[model samples]
Each structure stands twice: as C-alpha cells, then as structure tokens.
Target chain A: MELKNLGEFNFIHSIESDTIYDPNTVVQGIGDDCAVYKVTEGYEQLVSTDTMVEGVHFSFQYMMPYDVGYRLMTANLSDIAAMGGIPRQVVLSVAAPGHIDTRILEEIYRGVKEQCQHYHVNLIGGDTVSIDGPMVWTITIIGEIPQGKAVLRSGAQPGDVVGVTNYIGYAATGLGSLSYNLDGYPMTRIGHQRPEPQIELGITLRELGVHSMNDISDGLSSELNEIAKSSRVSIIIDETLIPLHEETYKLAEALQTNPIDYALLGGEDFQLVFTAPKELSKALENLGSITLIGEVIEGEPVVQSVTKAKEIRLLEAKGYNHFHE
Target chain B: MELKNLGEFNFIHSIESDTIYDPNTVVQGIGDDCAVYKVTEGYEQLVSTDTMVEGVHFSFQYMMPYDVGYRLMTANLSDIAAMGGIPRQVVLSVAAPGHIDTRILEEIYRGVKEQCQHYHVNLIGGDTVSIDGPMVWTITIIGEIPQGKAVLRSGAQPGDVVGVTNYIGYAATGLGSLSYNLDGYPMTRIGHQRPEPQIELGITLRELGVHSMNDISDGLSSELNEIAKSSRVSIIIDETLIPLHEETYKLAEALQTNPIDYALLGGEDFQLVFTAPKELSKALENLGSITLIGEVIEGEPVVQSVTKAKEIRLLEAKGYNHFHE
Candidate 1:
C-alpha cells in the first residue's frame, strides 16, 4: 500500500502487529513516542533509532551538526512518546568527516544530552568514525513506557474518531521555508531546526485509551495509510476539518499551493495521529489542545474527504520514497 | 578514546552503564551480544544496532553483500551474547543507490535471516534509504537476557588471568591480505571475510567467575589497554606466550614486518578477551582451543618478553586508529 494517506502511525501499527513477538514482553510496540518493552518487572525499557544523511534525507545547506543532533534526538524521543514511554538513556553512532570540529562534535553530543536530560534520558555509549563525505548519525534511545501498559498502533477499529495532537503542516511549512524563500511565518525557522516531540500527550492518550496511534514523520496522509493497512480498515478525513496554523496557511497561499496538500503530504511533523472509539472520544474533547479531523471506516484502504458536493478520494500515497526520485 | 582502540564490548559497556536509568527492569545492559530487558514477568526483550560503511570500515571489492550481512549480523549477535541474552528480532537500515540489485539485497537479508534463525533471532523492522555513494547498513538487534544475571565489562579485578577465547589477529590479517598483496597468507583472506564472534564462549564465561572482558576487535594490545583503563588495573602480557597462526606469520615474514607485531596490532578478531582468577584460569587450561595470553596486574600495562635474555617492552597504544589515514 501507498505510504501517503495512511500516515506514519498506521504504517507502523500494521507492521507492529506482525512484528511483535513475546507480546508479554513488549509493553508497547510501534505507534507511540517509542517502543516500550519491560526490561524487568518493575522497570520499563524504551528503544528508538533515527538515520539522517545528506542529499537524500537532508541537505548540507539547511543542516548543521548541532541541528542534526537535535533532530535525530527528537526523532528517537518521538518513538518514546508513541509508546507512552519515558526515555532514560541513549547511544549515538555518528559518521562524519575528520575535519569537523571536536567542539562541533561536542555540540552534537551536547544537543543530544540536552534533549536526553530534558526527557531525563542519560547520554551513554557511542562510536565516532570519520567519513569522507556527508555525515550520518544514528541514535538508539532506551526509555521506560511505564509498568503494565504500553500504547500500540493497532488498536483502532471502525466507529472510532480520528484526532491529532496539534496543528499539522508546521514542519512542512518549515521545510518550505528551507527549500524556498518564504517570509512572515513565525517559528518556521525553529520548526525546521528544533521540532518538538509530544511526549506528555502520548502518555495521556495511552492512559485515556486512544486506540490505534502513530507519530507524524512521513506526513499526515502517509501515516493514516499505514494504520489503515495494518488495521485492515479505511479512514475518512475531512479536508476542511484538518487544522492548519495561520503560518502554514499563509505560506501555502503565498506559494500558490494548497494548504490541505501540505497538511496531507508534508512530513517531519512528529505529531501524534490517533483513533479512539466514539465512547472514549469525549475524554479528549475538553482535556487539552487537540483537533478532531476524521473517523474510521470499514472498507478498502482509502481516505475519503467528506464534503457537500461529493466525497473526494485522497488515499493516493504522496510523500517521500527512498527509491523513487 | 578512539573507536579502533576502544574495542566493541568495552565501549558498549561504558555506554550502557553511563546511559541507563532506573535500570531495575534491565535484565542485561551492554557487554552482551544484545541488550536484554524484561518486558513483563513472563517475557523479555532484546535490542542491538550495528553500522557498516564503505572505504573507511569495509571494502566492496573484497567483501560481498552476503559476507557483509554475515559480519554485521554476527556483530549484533556478539552484543546479545555479551549480555548472556538470546536474540529475538532485528531491524536493518540501509543507505544505497536505487540501481543496486534486488537479488543482492534479498541475499543480504537472506543471510541475515538465516543467521537469525540459526541463533533463534527474528528479522523485524528497519529503514531503507538511498544515498549518493557507498552503501551503509545499520542493524538494530533485539534480544532477551535472563533476569538478574547479565555480565559487565567493569566487573574484573586484580589477580585475574587474562584469557582469550580463540586465536586473534585473523580479521586484520585478512584485511591486510586484500590491500597488501599477501599472497603467502591464505588464512588472512578468510580472516578478513568471515570473522567469528565467540557467542557460545561469551555465555559460558558468564558462569566462570570472569571479571572484566571485551571482544578482541582492535587488536589484542588495544583491547587489553581498554580493560586496563576501565577496571583501573594493569595487565602484563608474556610476549613469547602469544599465539600466532602459521599463515599470518608467513605473510609477516614475507613483508619484513614482525609476525608478533602483526598479531598484537591487528584488529577485527572477534574473540573474547576476558579475565578470571588463578583457579578458574587453571580450570580453563584444557577447556578448548583457547589462549591464556597474560594476567591482570596492579601497577602498569606492559607486554614483556619471557624468552629473550634482555626484556623488550612492547610499543604502547600503537594499534589501529580509524581517524588516522
């Protein structure tokens, strides 16, 4: 199935169902801040890793080592959030050129440690090797998802309402700011350099029984498609109902591109996209900041838009592909 | 401080110890073939990650993708073994160009899966992306170690005999064969291609009063230096007692390089270098095809000649350096 409309969580949830063995050991697998496994009876373990490279995944003009460190750490923490896990330790294996400053290396580690300490995750073991070209860093994170519980990405079914933790397309807007010259968008620079992972919301959602879930790294549509494929169900998203920040809308309007397209296809959002049964949906209504976007359906894999004139099919995959140009 | 001299297990152990928090649930940390944690009372989880790159770390000319897969998988398995853990699942991340063959990729994964099944590990999740040049593959291994009994590299004390599970310097010899035209050294080629990780020996050592230990990756001298640094003890080696394979010595003789130096300085020998008390050392006298290279001391690190009339001190800290051209 295509990755676009299904979204990151859905893709992960589908994969998680088939991958999780020794379920009793995996307190939670895929679809949360991180994958939570019980390391022992009383304590929990968190694991997440991210790969960042030049040209394909990122560009040199837009990224620095410290920024790389910050983003990589955030990616890992996002995994921890998806699992309702709290991070405690991390190991970084970074490959770069020999001439990169020892301080720059220190800065990368410092950024990583800063995030870890912020999340209460400690900086531990790592390997630093010099390479000739673009730099590549992979950080493996270990955290605790809490005892006796973990949030999975495969629990959503029909009659469940779809909800998102924050306004989508901000990171994408930030990307637009990087790729093209866009002005007047606040936090666009910060969003590109220092995207945040929603850890608290992930735990609350798990405790509140927010069914199937995932983080929005591969754009909103891609994540939804993943959940749909994994749960073997369909999702219907309201095109107009998707919440977009004024910055994102303004940027899209300036670029002459549809804001809905950016919301649907822009990646690196790192927000939570979850589904919950109708009965449990009310718990999230007034609980905090959230936006109700759509609902689950029982049919073929497709995200249909609900509108007055006609229901539009928006299920075609529309984000990044490693192999495709 | 450099990776080449740090050795794998010692580096990982340092990271594991410093990184983990509320590690009550961690059945096993670093020092094993994988990191094992209890997800629940009834089940356990394992996780590990290995990164391989071109030119600096490996050469495509001498190593096939299948062999790369084998070596990478073995590296991950070594982590699991160090923890006294069993492998359950693995996630592989690869960065390569689109033109790479599907069959080669399948064969690589086939080798990985074969080894996993052989060791009772599973192939679970991973990321794949295209890069500008050279293929870099990173695999994260998940495993299970028993509760309360994982080994540590920092557990060694003085008065312990330094033991090596098998012959050292083969992998480095093999690497030398590829680049230096070592026609006489048939074994060096094998060493470069398929170095074994002493998985069984690692698990067995955990029950043998073994103290500080690490894999002999960056030469015997380099690994010994790490054990000395970490356990805060000196290790004195009897130079004459060191083991040297016939082919390695033959090649070294042809090249005017001392076979002893090659054996001592060569890296990528994935055998276990560990310490045990005198009684346990004697018990290991005829255990298997192994080597009792030296003993842990109280004062300073030294490798002295036992046969020559005048004692010759071995060169200090002159092993492989990844950063050195």
Candidate 2:
C-alpha cells in the first residue's frame, strides 16, 4: 500500500522496532520527543550530517531502496570514521512522497537498522514527513573519540607522506558498468552500490600517528585538495602509485576509458586517506592494503599529478559537486 | 544568480562564519568531517530531528525565506524543550533545486543563525545538496538535561491535571488571515510565522514537577491524544477552559468559524502542554499564563471533549498527519 493510505503514524508504528543494543546507555529510544542517553565522561562528541535525494544523489535506475539506505548510512558514517571516532547514536529525517510505497520505506529502514546494528549505533529518534517531491533521507550521526585525538583536515604538513586504504576507482567503474549494462565485474558494481565506511581503518591510522585524515567520498581529488587547502600545503601524487581494482582496470579497458579519471572524478568511495610522518612508512606498509600514494610538499596549496614517464601536470582539485554541472 | 551558477563550495564559503560560542567545549565546528565537542559529565544527552518541505510543511506565499528558517528552527527547538532540556548544538541538511536563487538560501541561513545565536545553540555542521525537487531542510538538534530529569510523554498518570501555557489557536487564525488577506490581526499572522520555543518555561515547568509534557506543534488534539495513548490514560478537556487569544476570537467571529476548532485542529502553536499533580494547580496558575484545560481519568485511552452546554463527544485522536490526507 502507498504511504498516503497507511498514514504517517501507522507507517511509523509499522516500521518501529525494539532494536536498542545497549539499555544502560540508551535511556529511551524511538518513541519520544527527544532521545535521552548517558554521555561517557572524558570523551569528546563528534557530529556530522549527510543527505541523499532521489534522482539527484541516487536513483532506482542504479540502486534499490535497500541500497539507497545502505549507501546513505555509509556516507554519513564515513565522516565519523574520517574524524577517528566511534559512532554511538544516530537520528534520521526521511521525507518521501506520499505516493511512494510503504514497503519501500520498510526496506529502507531495514537497511538502516541492520547497518546501525552492525556498528552498535542506536537508532534513537527520527522525523518522517510526507512530501510531494523526490524522497530524501538525512542522517545525523553522533560519535565519540578520546579528547584531543581527532585528526583534522588542517593537520597535514610539509614532508608528510600521504596514504590511502584499498584500491580507488572501483566505485566509479561500478557506476559505469551498471549504467551501461556491461557484463561481468560484479565487484565493481557492488562497490558502487555498497561502499563500506572504513571505521576500523580510521582507528588504526590514528593509532599509527597519522597527522591528517579524510574519507574519499567525493573522489580522491576533492579529498586531496581539501587537505592541501586546509593545511596550507601542496600535494603531488604519483599516477603509477594510485591503485585501481582489477575489475576497474578490466572494465576501463573494455570501455576504452582512462581509469585514472574514475579515481579522480568519480566519488562514493568510502575509503580512508591520511598523511603521516615519513618515518612511519615501514610500519604503515606492514599494515596490508595501505598504499603510499603521494607526498605533502611546501608550495601553493594545489594538487599536481606526476607520471612515471617523468611528465607532470596540474590536476584540478574539482570533483563530483552537486551544484556544479 | 541560481545556486548552480554559484557552485556548492563557493556557496558554502560565502555562508561560512567563525561563530564559536565556547572554544573550550567546541574543539572543532564547521569545515570538519564532524563537529567535535567535549561532553558534559553526569548529564544525559537529548537528540531529535525535524524536517520541512517547501510545499508540504510550508509555502513561500505564507512565509518569507527568513520566516521559513525561523519557524523551522523553532519547530526543532520545541522538541528539545518538550524534553525539558537545553538545546546546545544543531546540524542542518538542506536540499534545494539547482534553479533556486542563492540569495534565498542566504536569507534562510541568516534567520537560522540569528535564532540559534539567541538560544546559544551552535550551528556546527551541515550538508547542502542540489536537487531536482523542491527545497527541503532538516535540522538535527543536540541537547542535554540533568540525569533522569527529562519529562516524557508517558509520565502522565490517572488524576493528573492537564494544563497548557499561554494560548492556542492563534496560529490557525493567523494562517487564515494570511490566506484570505484579512485585515486587523497582525498578531495572528506573526504567530503563524514566528512561533517561539518555550525553553525557559519548560525548565520552570519541570522544576514545578510536571509529570508529562509535549509541545503543541501538531495542535492540542494530537498532543492530548499522544499523551493519553502513551500514558495509557483517558483525558477530558473542557471547551470553556480551552484558552484562545482575543485576536483569535475576533478573527474567528469575522470568519464565522468556531475558535475551538482552530485550537483543536490547527497546529504550529509551539506551546507547551503538561500534566501535574492536582496539588500543583495553584502553583501552576500563580505562574501566570498557565491554563487548566483537562484532567486525566481512569478509563480506556481515549480523548473526549465536553462543551460549556454540558454535552460530551468523543474527539478523534488524530491531527495533522502528513500522509493521512
């Protein structure tokens, strides 16, 4: 049945669950004006919000309702991960068209609930409104970190080594594969639909004394430029050092597309990127899948790409921006 | 110019402010992956979110950009006040069509910033996205209250006295005035456009030992019905005791409509309704502007209304549901 027929209160009751993970910390959940919970002493709180709108951020042409919810949560949680914090609570605001199916909302909530449960984050309180526009979901996450331990975008410094977790360009290729109905490359397609937040990697990087950090949400270019601008330092990344998933390389070859473009321009890669002192390079390498991709240098805060063939060119720090065509 | 021409990062930079209320607690604010702040010890945190859509929750015809932002914040803050908590920080997620004028967005932010500044609430972090749909804004608020002291909707008990602050029905009449371009009722129009969050009054009511409380954002009918259902108690409200502003009565008389219908069905009042022990009525009344409206009784959880003519009728326990229509 459509949501308009179900009614707001009925839809909420239909999807509400007894899903509190920790009763001691959560005094109340789901059914209240505001969720009241205990705050741990000596900890700093981290808060961030992310929004996804139908036909703008994602569409059913590329993702299911479950995938939409899953990816939206991942995008929001990645911000917490980027800050080297552990997510504890979340509140959601969902606005869907009244003509939308109630089951779609249920599936969306299921994805949200399962992901939050996996991370031990409480789904505390939310607002659900019926709208006449495309469906949108906004998640505000609360996380906690040890006081004075949050990695900042401005913490990168000259002589620091820049690194990333896992291969880039996978999600972009995944989007391409799905859009064009390309065969094979199941991993690349999954990457586009189910980007995973690198929470544990963030904690590890913090422990390794990483100076600065960000999640590659709007592609590597935006992340690198933001760090450079915030830290007032320049970054030079080696094109050869940038890793691409095997599926991404294969799909790029089949489509005759430069894989590097995907890594630079395609977003939705919820992977961790950080800069640390050069001396920790050996230790970082010991940790599997950590790629030393670039160096922070003393210059104007701009990003330049250098090829192994000794050619160098300035790379635009622009990425997939919603307001920029 | 439209937001598409201005671009997302440029728009963000234009609106970015260095407004930090307390540096000691706020380690980081805007321009970070997540806002970081020190958590207060021995206190419980309160969190809630609210959403407003351009055509569903409001319209530009009845409100300017400033009023939209102002009323949106008030609606969210009222939830925090309903829990007897002091609002501390807020994060916003705004999605607007790329065709929208950037100046409208600037005006909206100005209103939000001014209102937040007045309440000492920090606008720490938010997401701004371009969509192909109507403008939508979601605000997630973080508040804190003394441990175990927050009022809940389920705290009302049998024999508790129900009371409301100030008056109700002004906003509906105000909406009516704006809709028909009626003259001679400026207060009602302002009331509809600018409902204030009763934070101080909430604290006072909590100290005066209010059992259960709600903010009348969805009118008295919804508030009373929710309280009754949550507390598993019956409520009987007297028609004569339902307070109405003098302006509301005049507008209703001019329009030839029942003022009580406005109080019962028209929402956006942002007034507080609470229940207290019978002995506290004198204290509550002495506080000024508090009206005794109803009494909780032992019966099936239903809401009923009695007229001054001594006739009783079952009041439908529903109000202002977005999907119900």
Candidate 3:
C-alpha cells in the first residue's frame, strides 16, 4: 500500500504496535512528543547517531530493505559497543519518497524489530517524513554504562597490546563477491549484509581493563589510526599476525587484488580493535577469538605495518572519507 | 570550498571547534564513536528526534542553510520542552549531496552553534554522509527532568484550563508572505525562519501544576485534539480568545482567507499549549504572554470551537501529513 493511502497516523500506529515492550526503563514510548526513560542511578548515558542514504550507503539493487534496516541498526549498536556500554533504547528518523510501497517499510521494521529483540533494546520514538529525495535512515541509540566504566579512545599507553576481536577482510570480500556475482562464498555475502557488533566482547574487554577501543567501520587501518591519534601513541603491527579468512584470500586472488589491502583498507568490518596492557594478553586470549596484532609505543600518532621479512612500511592515514569518496 | 576538498575528517574537526562546551554533564563530545554524558541522579531522560529534508521541510530558495539548521534544532528542542524537560545534549546526522559547497555546511553549523549556546545545550557526536539525494538533517536531543515532574499529554483533568504560551498563526503568515513576497510581515517571516521553543515556559507551567502540555507544531486544532485524545477528555475553545498577530489577519484578508483558519490549522508555530487547574488561573495569567483559550471537560475525546455568536463547531484533527502533502 502507498503511504498516502495508509495515512501517516495509521502508519505510526502500525509501528507502535510492532514495537517491543520494555516496561523497565521506558516511562513512555510512542504517542508522545518525546520518549521518556528513567536513568538508573550511578550510570552514565551513551548516545550515537548514524545515517544511511540510499545509493550512497547501499543500493536497492544490491540490498534488500530488511538488510538495509538491519545494517543501520548494527552500525549504531556497534558505536555503543565501542564505548563498552549496553544499548537500551533507540529512536529512528526515516525519509522516503512517496513512490515507494509501504510494505518495504514493514520489512525494514521487521529487520529492526529482530535486531532490537536480539539486542534487548527498545524502539522508543522517531519521526517519519516523505521526501522527493532518496530514502534516508538515521538512528540514534541511547545506552548506559556504570559511571567511570565507559572506555574512551584516548587511554592507550606505551607497551599496550593492540588486538582485534575477530578476522578482518571478510566484509570487503563479501562486497566483492556480490559485485562480481561469484558463485561461492555465501558466508562472505552474509558478512557484508549483516555485520555483527561485538557488544559482549566490548564489555568483557572493558571488564578486563582494556585501555582503548574502537569499532572498525572505516577499515582496520583507519580505526587503529584513530586510536593512535586519540591516545597520542604510535602503533606497529606485524603483517603475519593479522588474521584473514581463507575465503577472503581466495576472493582477493580471483579479483587480482591483495587480500592485505582488503584487511587494511576495506570498510564496514565492524570488528573491535582495542589496546590493553601486556599482562592481560592471557586473559584476553581466554575470552574468545582475539588476535594480538601490534603494540603501542611513545612516538608520533602514526600506524606502521611490519612485513614478514621485518621490513617496516608506514601505512597511509587513508580510508573511506565520505566526502572525498 | 567544496566538501570534497575539505574532506570528512576536517569537516568534522570544523564542527568540533564550533561545539559549545558543557563541563558538567558532557563527558565526551564530537570525535568519539559515541558521545558520553553523565546523567544526574533522580532525573528521567527525555529523547526526541526530528528530521528535515531539503525540498520537503525547507527549500534553499526560501531558507538559508543557517536557518535550516536553526529550525531543525528548534523542532527538536520544542519536543523536549513539551515534556517540561531541560535539553542538555544533541547528536545530529546529516546527509548531503557531494556537489554542495562546504561553506554552506559551515553556515549550518554556525547556526547550530548559535542555538546551542543560546539554549546552553551541547552538540555531541554525530555522523555525516555523502548522498546522491537532497540534504537531510536529523537531530536527537537528550534532556532531563526530575522524576514524576514531566508534563504528559495524558494528564489533563476535567475543569483544567487550556492555555497557550504565545500568539499563534504567525508562522503560517510568514510562509504566506514568503510565497507571495508580501511586505509588512517581516516578523512573521522571522517567525517561520527561526522559531523559539518555549522551554522556560514549559518548566514554569510544570511547576505551577499544569496537568498536560504539548508544543503547537501541528496547528491549534490538531494539538488540542491530541491532548483531548490522550487525556480522554473533551476540550472547548472560544474562538475569540485565540491570540493572533494583527498582520496575520491583514495577510489572511488580503489573500481572501479567514484569519481563524490560519490560527486553527497552521503548523510550525512552536508555541506551547497546556492544561492547568482552574485555581492556578491567576498564576497562569501572570506568566507573560499566556492566553487561556479553552477548558477541558469529562467526555469523549473531541475538540469543539465556540463562536462569538454561540455556535459550536467540531474541529477536525487535520494537520500537515508529509505523505499526503
């Protein structure tokens, strides 16, 4: 059904009914000018917003509406996770052209609902607008962490171990598979479509006294550079320590590109990169699939990659800049 | 300079410098993956998000980029004000076409900074994306109010007086003036371009035991209908009591339309409409520029307007629907 035929109020009502109930924190959700929530004592609040514009962030030809919504929520959830906070509430703002069918929004909301249920976050309040421009989805997530427990990007210190939560380069390889329509690599396609946020891993790292952390939304190199710049430290990573899925290397070979390039420069991996003191290496390894990739040193805020042969190469501070791209 | 030349990181740096500092609640602002704030104890949090699309919400031919930013912030602030909450922090998500000039965004941020400083709200973290579509601005405001002090739309009681904070219909007249190039309505034009949210007034009303409140963004009739429905009460307004600017009448007469229509149906006024007990009538009257225009009665949710000639007319709940428009 067309949105005009469904009417804005009724459409909002549909969303209200679809929203998951959260009686504990939510004082009031939809049907009000603002969503009200009771903040627990001794907790600090975390907020992050992300926008996805059709044709810029994703193409309808390549992404289902459900995938689009799921990816948008994942991006916001990842930001909260990067801070070692538990995401609790979200508000979304959506703008779409009138020519689109309303069922697409339902599918999108379904994806959103699935994510919210899985993450135990409430869809509190949001606004919807009809525009002549392409569809744009923006979500603001509200999360919480115990006072003084939230981590920042400026805490890394010299001799701290730089580690990542999981294998990198899979998301880029997934995009490549879809772009080339490769027959195999279903996992890579799923990786690109539904990147997971390491929420539990982030909390565990924070509890384990990790110094600084960031989510790899703009490639591993850019995230590491951010941590280094914020903490005013230099980081040196060994190329041989970096973990890559075997399929990623196979896809890189098929595309005649270096798999290392995808691991370092490709974006939207959503893996966690963090720094912790050397003593915590055993504890960090015991948690899960974390790999120690580098160490922090007192120097200019830069990232350098050491080759397997012990040759040092300075990595350019370049990644996906939305404007420059 | 074009945004392409400025680049995303530098653009974000520009915004970071423009941000107003708040040392108490803001733990971190721009540049982090997520902004962090320390919520004071015994306060409930209020969150509201609003989106403005370039062609749909404002046209560049009519609105300067600075005004666009200012107005977008105003809309979100008004939502918080409706709940009698003190807005503290905001996160913005912006998507713009790559061809746009970078200076336009600078101007937009300048206006945002101006509002933040004026309101004492901090600009926190946000995301910027390049789109192939029209510019879209979405802002999420975080606010706080003492527990149990938030004025909701469902709290109006029978015999409560319905009051408005300021004069109405000026914004509609402003749009009329801009559309027709009508002179002698500069104030109305300014009203449309830069609305002032009634944040202080809302707090005062809440202190005075005002039962319910809402911002008049969707015309007096629609706002009254919302309160009536939410509070499960009928409201009767005397048409002659509505405070409208003299110039609004002049413009309405010149355009061969009833001035009352604008007062009843115009959108984007950003004035506060509230319900308070009758015993507080004198205190309400003392508040500057307030006008009591109606009374709540125990009945079905409906809004009826009483003419000077003693004729009663049912007011339809009609307002701007983006999809229908």
Candidate 4:
C-alpha cells in the first residue's frame, strides 16, 4: 500500500509496534509529544545528529532501504562510541515521497529495530513527513557516560601515542568494489554495507586512560587533522605502521589508485582513533587489535606522514567533501 | 557564495560562531563527534524530534529563510512544552541544494541563534548535507523536568474540565489571508507566520496540577480526540464557550466559511489544550488567559460539540495530514 492510502498515523503505528522496550530508562515511548526518560544519576548526557540524503549519501542502485536505515543507525552510534558513551535512545525523522510503498518503510523500520535491539537502545519518538523529493533520513542519538569521563579530541598531549582500533580503507574499498561490481571482496563489501560501531572498544580505551579520541568517519588524514587541530598539537604518522586490509590494496590496484591514498582520504571506516600516554601503549595493544601508528609533537596544528623512505611528507587535511561531491 | 564553494566544514564553522554559551550544563558543543552535557541530578530528560520539508511544510513564497528556521524551532519547542518540560539544547540537521546561497543559510542560522538565545538553549552538534532535491530541516530538542513530574495526555479523568490557552481559528484564518493576499487581518497573518509556543503556560499548568495537556499543532478537534483516546474518556465541547478572535470571524465570513470550523480543524495554532479537575478550574482561571471550553465524561472515546441551542453534533477528528497535504 502507498503511504497516502495508508495515512500518516497508521503508518507511524505500524513502525511503533516494533520499538524495542526499555522500561528501566524510557518512561514513555512513541505516543507522547516528547519521550521522557530517567537520566541515570551521576552520568552526563551525549547527543549527536546525522543526516543521510538520497543521491548524496547513498543511491538506490547500491543500497536497499534496509541498508540505508542500518547504516544511518551505525553512523549515529559511532558518534556516541567516539565520546566513550553508551547509547540509550534515538529519535529518527524521515521524509519521503508519498508515492512510495509502505512495505519499503516497514523494511527500513525493521532494519532500525534490528540495530536498536543489537545495541540495546530504545526508539523513543520522531516525526514522519511527506516530501515531494528524494528520501531523507535524520537520526538523533542520545547517550550517557560517567560524569567527566568523556574523552574529548582536545585532551591529547604533545607526547601522546596515537592508535587506531582496526585497519583503515576497507569501507572506501567496499564502496569502490560495489560501484564497479568487482568480485571476490566480501570483506570490503560488508564493511561498506554494515560498518560496526566500536562502542565497547571506546569504553575500554577510556578506562585504559586514553587521552583523546574520534571515530574515523572522514578518513585517517582528516580524523588525525581534527585531533591535532582540536588539541593544538602536531601529529606525525609512520606510513609503515598504518594498517590496511589486503583487499583494500587489490581494489585500489584494480582502480589504478594508491592504497595509501584510499586509507588516508577515503571515509566511513567508523574505527576509533585515539591517543594515550606512552606508558599505556603496551596496555592498549594488549587490550585488542589496536595499532600504534603515530605520535603527538609540539608544533603547529598540522598532520604529517613519515614515508617508508624515511622522509617526512605533509598531508593535506582534506577528506570527503559532501557539497563538492 | 554558494554552499558548494564554501564547502561543508566552512559552512558549519560559519554557524558555529553563533552558538549560545551554556557553560553550566554543556561540557562540549558543536566540534566533536557528539555534544556532551551534564544532566541535572534530579531530573528526567525529555526528547522530541520534528522535521520540515520544503514545499511540504513551507515554501519561499510564503516564508523567508528566517521564518522557516524560527518556525521549525518553534515546532520542536512546542513538543517539549506539551510535556511540561524545559527545553535546554537542540541539534539541527539541514539538507539543501548545493546551489542555494550561503547567505540564506546564514540568515536561517541567525534566526535559529536568535531563538536559542531567547530560550537560553544551547546549540549542540548536527549535520549539514547537500541534497539534489528540496530543503529539509529536522530538529531534535532535549529538555528536562523534575523527576516523575511530566504531564501525560493519558492522565485525564472523567469530570475534568478541558481548557485552552488563548483563542483559536486565528492561525487558519491567517493562512487564508496570506494565501489570498487579503488585508485587515494583520493579527492572523502574524499568528500564522510566527506562532509562539506556550512554554510558560504549560509549566504553570503542570505546577497547578493539570491532569492532561497537549499543544494544539493539529487543530482543537484532533488534539482533543487524541486526549480522549489516550485517556479513554469522552469529551464534549461547548460551542458557546469556544473562543474565537474577531479577526478570525471576519476572515471566515469573507471566505464564506464558519470560523468554528477553522477552530476545530485548522492547525499550527501552537496553543495549549489541557484538562484540570473541577476544583482546580478556578486556579487555572486565575493563572492566566485560559478558557474552559469542555468537560470529560466516562464514555466511548469520542468528541462532541454542543451548540448554543442545546443541539449535539459529533466532531470528526480531522486535522492536518502531512501525507495527504
């Protein structure tokens, strides 16, 4: 059935039926003007919003409705992870043409429900509106952390060691493989379609005394540049230490581009990039699959790369430009 | 300058400069992956999100960029007010065509900043993306109320008096005047263009022991119908007691329509419709410009209206349907 025929309230009721129950925090959900929740005492709140517009963020050619909803939730969850917080609730607003089938929206909501159940988050409240244009999804996530426990990008010190949770360039390579319909790159394809938010890894890092952190959403160079600029410290990464999946190299070779470039400039990795004191470097490494790739230095707010040939090269603090694209 | 030339980051930076300072509660704002805030120890958090799509909610023909931003914020704030909550922070996501001028966005942000400062709410983090279609603005508001003190629509008991803040029908008449370029309805035009959310009135009502409450964003009949359904009570409104502005009557006559119909089915009034016990009716009257227009009864969930001649008429729960519109 089309949305116009189903009407707005019935369509909303259908989606609300599958909301994850969270009685401990959510006082009211879905039906009220505002969703009320009890804030855990002695904890701070964290909020972040992200928007995905059709034709700009994704195309129907490469992504199904389920993928779009799942990825949007993943992106918002990654923001909470970057803050060392546990996500608790989300409000999603969607705008789509009236001619669309109701089942498509139901599938999207099902994807959202799957992610919320996986993360133990509650779907609190949101708005659904009709548009005359392409579909647009905007999600706002609310999370909580212990008071004064949030690790900000401004906390890194001059001599801190920079580390990342996983290999980079996989998501970018996944996009490339999907775009060209290349075979034999399941890891990259899954990476782009369903990137995982490092929520547990972030909390562990915070407990491990990581000074500063960010999620790698805008590629390695741009993420590093943000850390450096916010903390007012110079950062230099060793080219040999940067981890890239083997599939990334193959895809870059097929596309006639450098794998390092993809690792540096491609985005949507959703891995945690953080800094810790040198004394905690061994502890960080022992905790998980984290790689120490760089060091903070006392200088201007710039990011540099030490090439394999032992020469330092300046890296431009540029990433995916949405408007330009 | 077009947004394409300014790029996403710089456009964000331009708006970041106008954020209101809230050092007491906000630990971090705008720059990080997530905005961080300290929650009050004895309060519950309230969250609500609303979206406005270009050509669906508003058009440049009827609204300036400033009005669009201001109205969107008003809509989100009204949701919090309906729950007797104090709005504190907001996250706004905007998706627009790349060819739109940067000054227009700046003006919109300026209007947003004006409202934030007026309400003492801080601007938190959000996303800005380029869309190939119409402009869409989605705002999420985070608010707070004393623990277990929020007023829900399901709390109204039989024999409670239903009341409303100020006169209705003005907004619907205002829309008509604006659309037809009719003069002599300046009040209606301003009412439609810059509707105010009754935040203070809501808090006062909650303090005065009001049972149920809702903001009249979808006309009086629709709002009353929701309350009746949620509370499982019948509501009977007195047509003689329903307040209508003189300007509304004049405009309705000019358009050959009944002003009562406008009051019943026209939306975007942003007025408060609530219920209070009979003993508290005097207290509600003393509080401000509140009018008691109806009474709740133990019956099927339906709304009826009583004419001056003692004739009863069933009222349809019809209001603004986003998809149908």
Candidate 1 residues B1-325, lDDT tens each? 3322333223223323222332444543332112334454654454545677777777668888777777778777776665555555555666655666655665566666657657755443345566666667777766665554455455567788878876666776677777876566667677677666666787677666577667766677776776676577777777767777777677676777777766578877777777888788666766776678777778754433343344656546555555554
C-alpha displacement of A66 in model 1, angstroms?
2.8
lDDT of 4 at B99: 94
Clashing pairs in 2: none
Give the TM-score comparing model 2 with the true structure, all chains together.
Answer: 0.98
| Candidate 3 residue runs with Cα over 4 Å from true position | none
Tens-digit lDDT track of model 4 for A1-325: 9998888988898888767556699888989899999878889999999999888887778778787788889999999999889999999999989999998888777777788989999999989999989889999999999999999999989889999988888898988898898998999888888888999998898888899999999999999999999999999999788889999889878989878887888899999999899999889889768999999999999999998889999987787888875
Off by over 4 Å in 2: B18-24
Query: What does DockQ come to for candidate 4?
Result: 0.86
Error of 3 at B203 (Å): 0.1
On the 0 to 100 scale, the lDDT of residue A222 in model 4 is 93
lDDT of 4 by residue, B222-291 (tens): 9999999999999999988888999888987898987788789989889889998999988888876899
Distance from true location, Cα of A201 in model 1, Å: 0.7
Docking class of 2: high
Name the candidate that leads on DockQ: 2
Docking quality (DockQ) of candidate 3: 0.84
Ranking by DockQ: 2, 4, 3, 1
